[model samples]
Target: MRRDDPIPLVVDLDGTLLRSDLLLESALAYTRAQPLRLLAPLAWLAGGKAHLKQRLAQAAEIDVTTLPYDQRVLDLIGRERAAGRRIVLATASHQLYAERIAAHLQLFDEVLATENGVNLSAERKRDRLLQQYGQRGYDYAGNSNDDLPVWAAARHAYVVSAGGRLQRRAAALGNVAAVMAPVAPLQQLRTMLRAMRVHQWVKNVLIFLPLLAAHAANQPTRVLAGVLAFICFSLCASSVYLLNDLLDLPDDRRHKSKRKRPFAAGQLSLGIGMALAPLLLLAAFGLALWLLPWRFSAVLLAYYAITLGYSLYLKRLMALDAITLAALYTLRLIAGAAAFAVPLTFWLLAFSMFIFLSLALVKRYAELREARRRGETAQASGRGYFPGDLEMISSLGAASGYLSVLVLALYTQDRATVALYSRPQLIWLACPLLLFWVTRTWMLTHRGQMHDDPVVFALKDRASLLVGLLFALIFWGAS
Candidate 1:
């Protein structure tokens, strides 16, 4: 065990050299490509994990370049290579992915991975290494308890972990050489909350629109129902957001800002996302069924169903994506009406559809602009949009927004308006306000200043908030 010993430095792949798992990555990629075959993984798993990995490796096309590699591991390999030591990559990941990753890094002199129905993990990995290098003949670098057997057999152990617990355990083996700690937990609770997209819960405010339109806000029971419905809808939406992030991992990794997201950046494990999504969905439905009316529960179910569809398929279909987004927004209003036991007015529905549709288009337009800025000439990744379609989207969005304003203007002259307002003419002021806000929104989108979500942007924009306040005041004066 001299300093110049020629013992090979063997490194583990998943959780050692990389911060993420290839098995989960390949499975998600396969699922995203063929969403209809989601059950295929279960059937494949019946053959065992090795068989599953082989099948997924053949089915999914993973971009190895975009993977989250551990820089500490890379630096270790670099220093070892400079010292004239042989470097080997030994992983339990499928051979296809392991080889691809090895080739991408171009540092490994040899690779040993799961192949031929033999999963190279734990005891199997130890046996394979003993066969190739003999007992206590090589230095091993690994993470997780699964590597304990291999570490026991190696001459020295290099523990790669975020915390000291694993390092302490590895030290018990009495051959611990070095510990390479990656960026530790940055408050995992905060990361999980971010993955849940709690900020986007502001969209659930739409659930109170029905109570406001029906002038039932003064009714304590109806107001309470609205609050409950908001909670249920927000939970459901957060579930969908998690699922969407899981599915959009590859695309998000290529985006500038999206790459920093918890899942895409490998700050959170995909297993956690997979488990939490359904739990949140169940909680949403449980709350709706137990506390809210059955009608509200039904609306919530429909909302979840539509969102699932959008996440799986509709979001990639050209105009349908925007239309579905608008429908989702309008469903919030319907949920509010159901919670308050109030009928949705035709005027309100029409106005919401047009306005939300315009906002949805703004979202798409902003994405396309971002792609153009990134110099991507092809279709927007994970979307059915081209940068060339920006002009058409702008036109359609502006027209839809103006149409909403027109709907508002016509509503002011309706018999319903005369009954609801003491001075109906004051409602006319809202039209110009709506028109101004919509025009400014599109203008910002065209100038590439719009956030990826127009609704979220509106919540933060100063002019948008001012317009909203003035618009609310006009409605109050009219009443």
Candidate 2:
């Protein structure tokens, strides 16, 4: 074949023209849409990969426009198309998704993808290309070891990889035309850590609430148990974060700020998240079972189950979502009490529920306000909330927060307060500070200045920190 001949440029879809795998994307989407039918994918896969892809494609609705496409690959294809080279989109993904992506890009002259019964990949892809273009009649761009066969048959190969390992292997075929640079591994690692949401572990500090409330911080063994409980809960929380991110991939991609998240942006692989979630959960349970009391383990297990439920279903229910979030936060305190074998007072539980419920509502309010800012008049995606419900939410959330303060005020006057604190009246001062913080939080949320997570916001907010310090001093003085 002459070098000047009109050789077509064929691009692989997953990890080539796009930064994500369609199979994994569709599978996750399917899981999110029909969580109850999660085991159905395994059954479909029993038939074959193509069959699995086909079933997922039919069940899951993927928005191709929002998918993470490789800009470099798009630019390359654009250049080739302008130069009158035929551009083909060849992917192992389902034909449904392949066609949709091709239609969205509008740069492919034809699409060759998995259809009917055959998965158009590896040897089959190579054979198909050979049958269409003869030897050395086309150029190819691909990623992954699965594309090695296609690369060997192409007149020119374009490698898309984060590192040179794949480039070195592709170059061995003696046809490498170019290499597309990918994000550095270190940067990708940081993004993956962000996906794990290590910062949100601050919420696990609630596990110390029981210790603090019981005035047992001076007890060395109790402190150690609290620390261990925090670690176990943090691990379990991170595990839930991973699974939630996986399930919320589609919804996250639609959100303005969340779109940049590692999983949503395709910076991290779904398979990694899937594998790490269960492993982290196991580690959390193992540590709890070995070191903590059986009651603590039970509480941790309950936390995981409820959180999993919230991620899968409860989160889509309007008021119930906030209630579930509050319950999760309260469970952290319960876990702490269980860890230390401390008696959980009714006052503490009531205060925790009301306060955390308010915070949960703040989270939802912020999301709705953000959606309104984007000029969306429809219901919040993947949530059972509409922008119009903002006022009612604010009303209910503020009232709930104030009720917590009322609980605090009443607790200060209780007979138990006299038994616990020498200067019980000093505890009364905390109620106004609690009220002030709650009011300010709602104000910021109403103004769309609050983070999605109120606990995380409190960790970073100067006002919230100052309030926390004052509240702690008041309690210490009372004790």
Best by TM-score: 2
Candidate 2 structure quality by residue, lDDT tens digits, 57-86: 999999999988888898898888887788
| Each prediction's whole-model lDDT (CA) | 0.91, 0.90
Off by over 4 Å in 2: 1-5
Collision pairs in model 1: none
The C-alpha RMSD of each candidate to the native structure, in angstroms, is: 1.6, 1.6
Give lDDT tens digits, candidate 1, residues 18-44: 888999999889988998898999999
Clashes of 2: 0
Superposed by TM-score, candidate 1 places the C-alpha of residue 44 at a distance from the truth, in angstroms, of 1.8
